[model samples]
Target: MECSDARMLLVVLMIVVAGSRQASCNVVQFIFGDSLSDVGNNMYLTRSLARPSLPWYGIDFGNGLPNGRFSNGRTVADIIGDKIGLPRPLAFLDPSLNEDIILESGVNYASGGGGILNETGGLFLQRFSLYKQIELFRGTQELIRNKIGAEATDKFFQQSFYIVALGSNDFINNYLLPVYRDSWKYSDDGFNEYLMMTLEQQLKLLHGLGARRLIVFGLGPMGCIPLQRVLTSSGDCQEKTNNLAINFNKAAEKLLQDLSGNLPNTSFRFGDAYDMVNDVISNPDKYGFDNSDSPCCTIGRIRPSLTCIPVSRLCKDRSKYVFWDEYHPSDRANELIADEIIRKLGLSQLNTTNSFSQSTAPSPAPFS
Candidate 1:
């Protein structure tokens, strides 16, 4: 071939290779929510009680050093990052990390004790609510635009994955507080509806801010957590709390369905965490867990009032316990949940156009 022809062929090959590499690059993930998906944002807060930067919290995590993750190791966000072939995004509040690098990769805006409503975690006095988290995300968006220009930043978000795992704290920290008497004011169904409506508005706000691919995790089986179990006389699951979570999940599913129909070019997946964790609690043996009702770390009576302090008794084998502390799941259980999430919404599956439609039903199989 002539030298000019050979040069043209080489240019074509380079363009094809570059395009392929861009297509194969892992999708950037921006996480938002409460403690379930919180990496370490609570650690940055001064007066937050919902912190995990202490001994035994990250015992299973490498180096046995707590980086503010509530579990005995990684959270679902960390596991999902690994599964999706991306490094776990740095917490947006971590001062040690470079802001530019974090924005380029992704950022975790989740905070422990956070909730959908601004007043939800007010009892804690220092939690970043979902509304505030989104406000922070808006700052990140500005930084992204500064770094890559507005057009490129818009495109970046279009190709990114957004995971939101919140609302559980609304019940755990706010409505259920004896001092609040939220139930008396709003009844059970009324409260759940209120939460769903607020969540729908926040999700729509996120979509407006450039998120296209989104995964909204439903409230888990809060009644079966160690904290709730301790509240019961027999230490059994609180059926009322469980029912509330189920109702919320059902409403959340419908919300996603509605959002998909209303929003243009948006793909929403509702992660049924209530069903996922409930299965593990119901059949611990099936998931290689020895204890599902009690937490691995406890002090007084395995209750919400007694958190995993520095002197708290730690479990010998953390993997066998479904919960690490009173409120959070063990790292093993997190792994299971994350794996299930990936299986249901893998990168290959996410690439399809069918995911954009409301007609596409989520996978119904429970986590193994």
Candidate 2:
């Protein structure tokens, strides 16, 4: 061939290869952690706290199945899934949903009793720990590879997003639950550092296994949870407990940013859950919330025993409240929060095809 023809052919080949790589980056989302984003993952498992069979859990979802979600309706994860244009995440343990469904958008590995550490308290029996959850994800991916053949699965791996929404249970169970205080034996700094070490290790492991992007959520205001309010103190929030969450979040933020810098073609980001919860709490009216201090559920005339759903009196207007129960938010509230997160990560308005553009949409409300 002529030299000029050879040069032109090489240029065409390069363009085709680049186009192929971009096409392969089809978005995959994997969710992990506790009740906050549990969806119905906990329901498939045999557990008393499971909510997949109850009222108010899927009031907005049309199908009306509780699906084990711990809210009066859809949780934040559902909203996020919608915003990203994916179906609701399938619970990893759901027997009804096959691996085909689980492998599509992704699988939700979150469990109600999950925690950062194995010994963290108050989790339901047979729940997977954060470490164990990662293992499940790894195993699922491998199963996908075997089912679809390695080449197709490799493309799925590269374009996927992994979300880790955890750490709250670690603080609540290990520190707040009475049963764990004597067993875990962690001082404040000791606990924080230990959790960080586990988190760092987990991120590295995921990265090694082909996770290209991750969003690790920081703990919210633990002291403000209705359950914590009922058990640890009066209506007043415990500043010390909230402070622990803040410390952990700040540290994780720094760690993730550093990890992104060191790793090529890999991004690790922090989800500012702490600020989002605080915003709703500090200025309830701004987000159409009338009460952020107390849950909308009915409580006993004396000490509380149950959440504000099914058996409890639900607020006349769930949108007016920040929390639906002790640890979950109403669907509207979750949609708003998901909007903020989508804006923060610039994940809004994905492309019609598998490609995405930098969102030109107006930024949502500032998180207080």
**Top model number, TM-score:** 1
lDDT values, one for every candidate:
0.78, 0.71
Residue-pair clash count for candidate 1: 0
Cα deviation of 213 in candidate 1 (Å)?
0.2
* Model 1: pairs clashing at backbone N, Cα or C within 3 Å: none
Error at 345, model 1, angstroms: 3.8
Residue by residue across 259-338, what tens digits does model 1's lDDT show?
A: 99999998998876566678989999998889998888877553464358866777767778898888988888887887
Give the lDDT of residue 104 in candidate 2: 51
Reference-based TM-score of each model: 0.86, 0.83
User: On residues 46-89, what C-alpha lDDT tens digit does candidate 2 reach at each position?
Assistant: 65453445665664454555657776666666666666765556
Q: If candidate 1 were superposed on the true structure by all CA atoms, what would the RMSD be?
A: 6.9
Error of 1 at 89 (Å): 0.8
RMSD of each: 6.9, 7.0
